[model samples]
Target: MSSSPQPEAELAKLRFTLEAANAAMWDIDLVANTVVWSENAEQVLGLRPGALSTTFVAEPEWIHPEDRAGTLTALWEAARGGETYVIEHRIVTADGETRWVTARGGAVLDDDGSPARVVGVLVDITDRQLLAERLRGELAAKDRFLTTIGHELRTPLTAILGFSAELHDRLSDEELAPVRDIAQIITQQADQMVALIDDLLVAGRDADSPVPIDPHQVELCGTVRRVIDGWPDEHRGSVSIDEGPVRAFADPIRLRQIVRNLIDNAIRYGGPTITVRCWETPIEGRSHLVVIDDGPGIPSTPPEPDTGVHPTGIGLAVSRRLAERMGGSLSYEHVDGTTRFELELPLEA
Candidate 1:
């Protein structure tokens, strides 16, 4: 009959299994300050596989200086306090290459119930750590590039707005009626362009909320009419509004911004006609503004900007944020083949 497999053979089989997993096993003697390693452990520790004592005199030196104290403390806690630990840290190889390693270990108790030894496994995680660092570096570089581009765009934009405002003022003084209309158009378009740049910079910030809004009691009908009238002459006839002196607690600037963005989107993306409506839901007693268009519906787009991007949904996102900052909410619904957007605000008492 074949003899039962010896413990030594079983141990060798276990070590082979560990080697197959790309892991190295270690057994540390608490009393002798020495360690026994699986055959493959030396390569994992960045050491040449050679005959050496069970003691690892240079092992502490291999650990990163910043991590050495913490590593020793963790080992002591596991060996003395019967705790288990998993640590990821850097180790210097024989050739001075830094590698990240993850170690998981527990202590074995002696017959007297005192800590006798610690056994552990080590794995190289250098590739994973390196990949994480690379991604973070790439993200940081992208943010810096966006900030620089925003600043560059703002320089020429500031000059354009200033000159347009000056020309608009001068045209009012002269009786050049035809050129006055053109000057007014340039000033209006310039103002809208500045709002777009402001939206870009504000929305691109790395923060939970980017819009800074101050809420006040705003008369709604006049504001809404003025905004609708400001639209291009061609699209003005396409929009209809319900005339009422409805009041809302909202930031005036943000309110106009939100209105313009919504109107702009409807004209750009909607079907033939659009309607603006408002009413107060007195159940909980609140005022809400509604804008509906015969558009297909609001569609989700890729978050990243593409070249030659339009202002349709781009400004819509920041409009929602500005509404929220003023203690209001912006919501969208598509019903009966019409796309509807509503801005709900607290009623100013």
Candidate 2:
């Protein structure tokens, strides 16, 4: 049978593990004003082995200038029976290079309930800090590119739509039927481009910025009908509107956008059958507008992480955001072989 290892052997193994993890254990004596470090301290702190002087007073010099005062205050507070000391800050190594580290420790009290010492660990986190900074920079660049492209495309689309409308009005005579058909097609395609540009602009803005809303009393049935009628003829097939009309206190423009996006999503991914319904709930004077389809619903699991594009599409995500910004909510449910997306809004502002 193998014998159990001695205490000294276990200590050596623990020191080896800490060194491999880019960490060092430390102990500080309050009364003696002295510090003791594991043998690997020099490696973690970017100094030659045996070059460090173990004194509590010398620690502040190692901390970055901006973090020195806060670090000292936290240590003093921990000694006075306060919370454990935990901080992530910059440190200046002996090689004159700045690095990020997280230090965590707690005070050890004596029999009289006074702090006699503190023990802690220092972990090098320079790689993690650098990675986070790079991600932020990439996100900012994406937002700027989206905003610029959205504005540029919108300018030409607006001109194309205006010209198409003018041609349609001037060529209304039966003799010019072929020319009028071409103009109508141009207007329809231009309208779709405008909607896409709106989504891009929304994606470019800061998420916390409030969406601009102008609310008023609006009839839900008419708004929903208008959006459906605007769809291209082929995409409008197999859609039926249920016969109850409801009113809501909401932004008409945003309501139209939400409705259009939902219908487009259903047409792209759902089964042939589709229905739109509107009704007032019995309690709270709230109303619901739902889009239903007979198709296999979205997967139970969430979309994959870090993919940028939503699984269903960006339209549904934008619709959900707009609904909440207008004091409403959008939810989804898959039940009894049918998928439903419901939007609820107040009857009064």
Candidate 3:
């Protein structure tokens, strides 16, 4: 076996390995206010690779103008306090093209404990930035499509519901039972369609520009009362509430959504029995708004196609997200002959 390699030989091997990985090395002389770069450094700086001295000629000219201030600040901090840092920024290439790179380095202190030099490596990351930008564009396009579809659907649905309501008013309940029933069905289904469209539009909204959640102490009983009262006549009587002065700290809009979604899901999927109850859980210092229905409980495995009931879909998932966003939690359990969904939230202090 060959003798152990010398320290100088090992350092040379490390430099070679870095260059092979497309990483350029940088060394800054703090006292001289000058920088020395490896041959590959020019490549990362957007300059022809042969020029070793091109880096310090004018550092800002090599960096993207928008990134120069932040980059210089990082470089200065490393030199001043011997701080190690990693920064990702764009560089302007000689061809006027912009490329992303990440630089990692720290100050090298002298014998007197002063910064003698700063050293680091730079690696290209343009591909990652391009992929992120592409994903954002695709998401924005999807949001616009949802908004356009909502506008298109609501226009015709409003007209159908209005005309059906007028006709229902004109005919006596005893005159044509079939025709009266048809008009009532049309109105109810159209209203449901409108609500579904609204929820779809809400889902596609820009998360960065979300309507701010405005949380405050709110009375759950009154909100439930209004929501139940607004349900279609046939479905309204099935829902019963025994909530009294139940209070929680929550965003009103989000609370309304969570309650409305639970109520609607119960009516559509819950077999025949449903109830809304609210009470304070003193042990947890929380308020529980519970919706109980006699539907088959959530399955151990998702339901198969054409089964008795499909699993809860996007609508309920969104409601769960909203509840969590407001410093609250939602849970589900199957009690004797009933499926219970409880929305647990903060009690007003």
lDDT of 3: 0.79
> What is the TM-score (0 to 1) of candidate 3?
0.77
C-alpha lDDT values of all predictions: 0.78, 0.83, 0.79
Q: For candidate 2, lDDT tens digit of each residue in 161-205?
A: 999989988997899999998998999899988997787566455
- Best-to-worst lDDT order: 2, 3, 1
The candidate that wins on TM-score is 3
Using lDDT as the measure, the top candidate is 2
lDDT of 3 by residue, 288-336 (tens): 8999999876656664465323355556766666777777888888878
What TM-score, computed on C-alpha atoms, does each candidate reach?
Answer: 0.56, 0.69, 0.77
Candidate that beats the other on TM-score, 1 or 2, i.e. the better one = 2
**lDDT of predicted model 2:** 0.83
Candidate 2 scores a C-alpha RMSD against the true structure in Å of 5.6
After superposition, the stretches of candidate 2 with alpha carbons farther than 4 Å from their true spots are: 47-53, 72-85, 109-115, 200-256, 263-313, 321-329, 334-339, 344-349
